[model samples]
Target: MNPPPINVQPLDTGTTFRSQAYHALKQAISQMDIYDHNDEIRLEERQLSELLGVSRTPIREALTLLEQEGFIRLQPRRGIFVIRKTKAEIVEMIQVWAALESMAGRMVATQATDEDIRTLWDLFRNFEMRNPKEHVNEYSDANIAFHKSIIRLSGSKLIQEMTDNLFIHIRAIRKLTIGQDNRAERSINDHKEIIKALERRDVDQAEHLIRDHTLGLAAHVEKHCDFLE
Candidate 1:
């Protein structure tokens, strides 16, 4: 039996080759083509390089990053396979992220200065202004940044490290989930409420809102997206 075909756009040479290759492939996995009918995806370095019209070096670099982020597993001389999480694992990850972000939100409320809150509102504007129909992908990146900013304000090296570690895995799942109906708009609203809660210096409210945002994401993804196993 033949393997499925993949269609990837040529890399934009304007960017660093590695970044170009990475984003191009990531976008393909996000939308265009990669997965098979069996809900799995596989590719070799040679196949990816040929598909993206780049050198093997950039293809290898992108695959390494993807593998690190838990999107793909590269078995030596076999091929790269997509590593889809189960619904149970997805719920667990989101629960942890909710706990982490809720802690970060509370810390931000208690510890973040007026200027810090001001910076958050300023960052919030980035998402506020986004046209989700035209810019969901960009909005997703901003949403990640918005959550990270609050976590950064926590001023604990440990919290920062944990959130950073969780983000790579979470991001891959988010890529699939964000395109769901009104997901971008809904996420923006949730962030708006969360920021307002933080700015009011309501610790409990901030924690609740942030957890709701993260867990809401879990529920949304569970309902709408398929976790390729």
Candidate 2:
């Protein structure tokens, strides 16, 4: 039997064509609109290209950049795949994230300007003030913003880059686990404790709080793997 015909189409004409394709693909992957067999998950370049009415060239380029950033993986002859994390992997990453974040927290406690401290406090207060009826997405967004604030205060570009890469995977896992209200509440409390320690300029306490908080989250997530899947 002969193979099916390939459906080739012309590329979109305009400047910013690649940028449009890149943003569309990034948004789709970030929003979990893509998935995989075993019902796992992934973002396919060809599908994205088709959806965005663009050529595969720009789609492939965007995928390549995302892969380099550790958000996706490319398998030889297979296709592009979203980087999925297992329970064990999430646990391990939580430990690393805790260490990195704690280090940032410690630095911020010692070196942060008054303005930095005020910004962080504002973010924390905003998180605390969120209405219970609001969607988990709101809380998740705030959570990311809070961490980004800490990273901004850390003054280490390398640390920021590494943590940003790790958090992409962490954020995906958090999306899986966000349905657990207990976990969400616990995470909020954890952030509070870390902030309190920072407020005191207690580096040791800040580090300990951050690590223990993350370990607690890992434990909570492990006990509720059903929510993760």
Candidate 3:
């Protein structure tokens, strides 16, 4: 069976149409479960054009940009499909992300306000009194949010920009694996430790815990996720 059609909003007239359409399409793709075991999902230009309330001309232009960014591929006669990275690529990307996030944690230890730390805690407050394993889906969303909030708390625009693309893959993978191997149960604990380190403003400890937590995901994908092979 075919996966659902790409979701997009009509382009805002105030912005340049092609750029607006490009962002719209990319956002939709990022939210898709491209790693799903189903057949590769295709992107139809006509459908996209109609959905975005634009002509084929701008849709074509927007697609070309997405293609160039390594987000999608266009085959001569086959169709456009989202690009799914191989296991090696996924592991390498996770490794890079681990480095970026660890540094972000260091910055957060030194720069984030007490309220920022509390806000991070708020993400998991409900789970604090319950078992995360019982609510894997909700915790997965909060897990992704927790990492993003840490980056934002770092107060480094460069780090935020660097991890933006990595997140496209990381979020998807985390959602898929969070329920496996009792991972969600372990993840909640790891997050609590990292947050505690940050709260104490322990830079070295925060960096080490954050790096270990992220690198642990890389190791999990490397050993487990055989589908990526």
Tens-place lDDT digits, model 1, residues 114-134: 888878666556545557646
Listed in order, each prediction's TM-score against the native is 0.66, 0.73, 0.96
- Cα miss at 129, model 2 (Å)? 5.9
Candidate 2 per-residue lDDT over residues 82-134, each given as its tens digit: 77677777778888887887788788889887676767666546555665225
Identify the runs in model 1 with alpha carbons over 4 angstroms from their true place: 1-76, 79-82, 126-130, 227-229
Candidate 2, residue 34: Cα displacement in angstroms equals 7.4
User: Model 2 segments beyond 4 Å from truth?
Assistant: 1-28, 31-38, 50-54, 68-70, 75-79, 124-135, 179-181, 226-229
lDDT of each: 0.75, 0.68, 0.89
Clashing pairs in 1: none
Pairs with steric clashes in candidate 2? 36-41
Write down the worst ten-residue block by lDDT for model 1. Answer: 30-39
Worst 10 residues of 3 by lDDT: 32-41
- lDDT for model 3, please: 0.89
